[model samples]
Target: MRHFLTALLVMILTAHIAIAQSQPVLNLELANKIADAAQEKATSENWNVVITILDQGGNLILLKKMDGTQIGSIEVAQLKAKTAFEFKRPTKVFEDMIKGGAVHLNTMPITAVEGGLPIFKDEHIIGAIGISGVTSVQDGIIAEAALKAVSLN
Candidate 1:
């Protein structure tokens, strides 16, 4: 009877753990809203920047380039967003790591740029946003504002 009770308890715990975790998905409406928020922030700051939004799987959801933004920034922005989504962390984390002598991280398919941020809902990452064409810190600021618009940090 004791062994049966212990096994039953373990099974119950396993089921609870599985039910407690779920992956959130990024939909088109949310992606557009996030991009729009980022663009608005950049405009308010008088910054011509490019914004890219990606789903948690690293698929591009939306891309926006403000007037006068550098053409090269479009690709950079996408790559940054992809890196953030796939790695499940802000691009700044990787940037700081590289700056702190983790130079080997450069060999991976990730960007050590500061403009990318992951978007989370219910403590789960649903997507990411990346901004470019300004100072790295400023770009991050714009992305962060976008994440805030969606109530994600």
Candidate 2:
């Protein structure tokens, strides 16, 4: 019985070590940098917008909205980032899924719209950032700028 307990502990410890090494750490400073880059991109076009940055688990890390931007944009950007985090894809993908008659869009607490994108580094999802108060294409562009600013391919 002692041997059996020892074996179980070894297996559990091995699994724990593997998981810890496999996981990526997405910190607040990185999230903030992405949000700031996106905000700069959007504002550079004379477009005031709201930006929301979320960690891997879809929790808000940072949120900002330029003055004169619509209040509704704040919630919109948060939802967009959350949607991307949950879906593990760009927010436009949800829009496509909805167009394909994906009923889950209505069922799930998600927005099948634009303005959100996954931040992948070293083939792992680090976080996501979203922008609102602009056109869908512009939103994507701003996100692209942020990704570039972070040098995250």
Candidate 3:
């Protein structure tokens, strides 16, 4: 019985290690890298925008507003990031649903708009990015470019 208990303990520890190893982590450095890429894209297009990054746990990691960007975009950007992180999908999904007559979603606590995207690493979401201060389509484009620049998918 002693030997069996020891084996079980070892198995539990091994499983814990594997689980930890498989989980993805996001930190400030990574968030800055992604925000930089997004800013670059916006600058190249002469579009001032606000960028927001949130960790998987819905914690704000970074927030940036390009020069001349509308101040209102700050909240919009954060809302977009929070919505994406909470839903585990692009905010565009909700936008599309709303356009398809899912108006009920408006009553929910979600920003059903474009410009929010989940940051994926190894098929797992580590964080999310949101852009505002430009057209919805343009914001989405910037977010996509940033993710591609960092090869985060």
The lDDT values for all models are: 0.87, 0.83, 0.92
Poorest 10 consecutive residues by lDDT, candidate 3: 144-153
Look at candidate 1 and tell me the lDDT of residue 101. 97
| lDDT digits (tens) for residues 50-88 of candidate 2 | 888887666788888888888888889888888888878
TM-score of each: 0.82, 0.79, 0.86
TM-score of 2: 0.79
Clashes of each: 0, 0, 0
Instruction: Tell how far residue 146 is off in model 2, in angstroms.
Output: 0.9
- Candidate 1 weakest lDDT stretch, 10 residues: 144-153
* Better structure of 2 and 3 per TM-score: 3
List model 1 lDDT by residue over 20-114, tens digit each: 87576898898988888888989899999998888867788788789899999999998888888888899999999999999999899888899
User: Residues 44-89, candidate 3, lDDT per residue (tens digit)?
Assistant: 9999999999986779989989989999999999999888988889
Ranking by lDDT: 3, 1, 2
Which model is ahead, 1 or 2, in terms of lDDT? Answer: 1
